[model samples]
Target: MRGPAAPPPQPGWALKAATAVVYAAILAWSVFSRGPEGLQAVAMLALGYAVILGLIVFAALAFFSLWRRFRTPRNRARVMLGLGVFLLAAVVPPFAEHNDDNRQRDIANAEIRKAIDTLRQQAAGGSGAPEDVPAIDPAPRASGPYGEMERVMKTVAGARLAQHRAYLQELQEIGLPRLFDARRLARDTGLIESRLILEQAERLVPGYRRQSLDVLNGMPALVRSLTIADAEKDKILAALQTSNAASNAKLTRLWDLESQILREFGQMITLLDDNRQYWYADKNELMFGRDGDLRRFRQHQESVSRMVGEQEQLGVQSLAAVPQAPLR
Candidate 1:
């Protein structure tokens, strides 16, 4: 019966139904997994696929029309020409859009690199706190075993020792002796001034003369006591000189240690500044898709922080070890 009625016109809609099912499944999954953003991404992908499919269909139609018009050579040539133009039109826009995006990205990257270079230059040229160590204050001049030892040390044979020796010797021989002489002179001047004041009071009032004589009688003993006090003062100064010598030695050692620590601290600061500059220069790489670079940068930062913390702690301990004077 007419070749089985052309096999019931084979169901061409079956393929389209299967495609629709696949698309629905993908959309459902996208919605379930990513919410609104997923839906947006899927919509964009679908739009792009639709455009591509439409282009393909148009191309296929043009090829089919060319075949159908092949009987007339002139018409065939014209159709082929039209198909080529249409194909170029369809392809060129997407390529141009892609090229434009690449150009924009390159321009942005170039600007970022230029900024990084400027930062690097600035960091390289920058200087911070002065690195020169401060001079230690001179030790006090006094008397006793410490002074004797210091006097001996001053004569030692090296240039370094010789300088310190000269300083201590000068303190002992000239500075302390001059200070003692000045103190004696001041005491005598004060005594003389007191006597003059009392004498003037006696001259102004006859009744006060008796009181002044009583005070004047006490003056010789006061002068004798002052002489005795001067002897005691010399003894005290001798003890102070010994104490001063020991204190000076300790202070010298502290100065040396502190200077070393300060130099190391300055170096650490410079290194940290350099590290900061490096981080700024590579910030885009660290922040964006460069996972490996980010990891390395973080590790370096932590290492440096830990090292500086340890050094600071050690410095604190060292400072604490130095003896401090008791508060009165």
Candidate 2:
């Protein structure tokens, strides 16, 4: 007769313990290592955990199959307990790590929004530009598709800047705020959250600034001619210095506003100038129309505004010599 069935094989406690240790070591190592390529590190950890999870799943299946052979209640209970531990050890960490990554990305997105809002307020305050307008320098004609396009775009952007600058000058001349019931809102740029707004401003600013260089252009010669016999010019100048129906002060704020817009406008010009191809439309036909006479005209226009205070005083001095006109 056959001897008593061989005693059931003992559970592989050593293998399970070693597996637990290995899994713990890999998780711990992946969690701790930080490096220059942070995204790469995160990706690597994700991959590592995925591999570890796969291995644990396979191992747990093997353990259950082998342990089920035993008929004793105590042995069966022990097998179930080991399975619980293995499942818990393998699944918990990857879930926690994924949640943490998502949370961080959300926080970063929020901060970026705050930064953009601040930028917007500063731009709209109408306080003028960040710095003095630089003298316009001619750039070499761009070649190739990209270069040509950039140049053309710069030209277009520059043209737009000039038009806005002219509009502002006209506003200052007749006085937009001074004449019209103009209202202005200078909300804080810190509140601007959108990147699209910032990008739009970036694209528009340089061209706006480039065109403004001539707002004051040829204005002096005309002012000199117009003010000669007409005392109204001087009066208009004085009205500009003080508040009227338009501006509350001589500083129309448009000057500063234009100045501010120009800063960005100037930048676009530089960017377009640098990348000519983006601006270029065709080989024979260029992007924007070029004008150099504008450069000289702006010089005099600025000089006129700067001397307005002294010019006003001179007007007072000259007024004493002229006969007073009769009122109807």
**Candidate lDDT (C-alpha), each:** 0.37, 0.39
Count clashes in each candidate, considering only residues at least 3 apart in sequence or on different chains. 4, 48
TM-score quality measure for candidate 2: 0.23
**Compared with the true structure, what per-residue lDDT tens digits does model 1 show for residues 116-138?**
33323322322211121112222
TM-score of 1: 0.21
| Residue 189 lDDT in candidate 2 | 26
Per-residue C-alpha lDDT of model 2 across residues 231-328, encoded as one tens digit per residue = 64465345333333232122233344434443443443344344433334343333433344334334544654555434334323322111122211
Stretches of model 2 off by over 4 angstroms after superposition: 1-14, 25-67, 70-111, 121-328
Residue 117 CA error for candidate 1 (Å)? 2.2
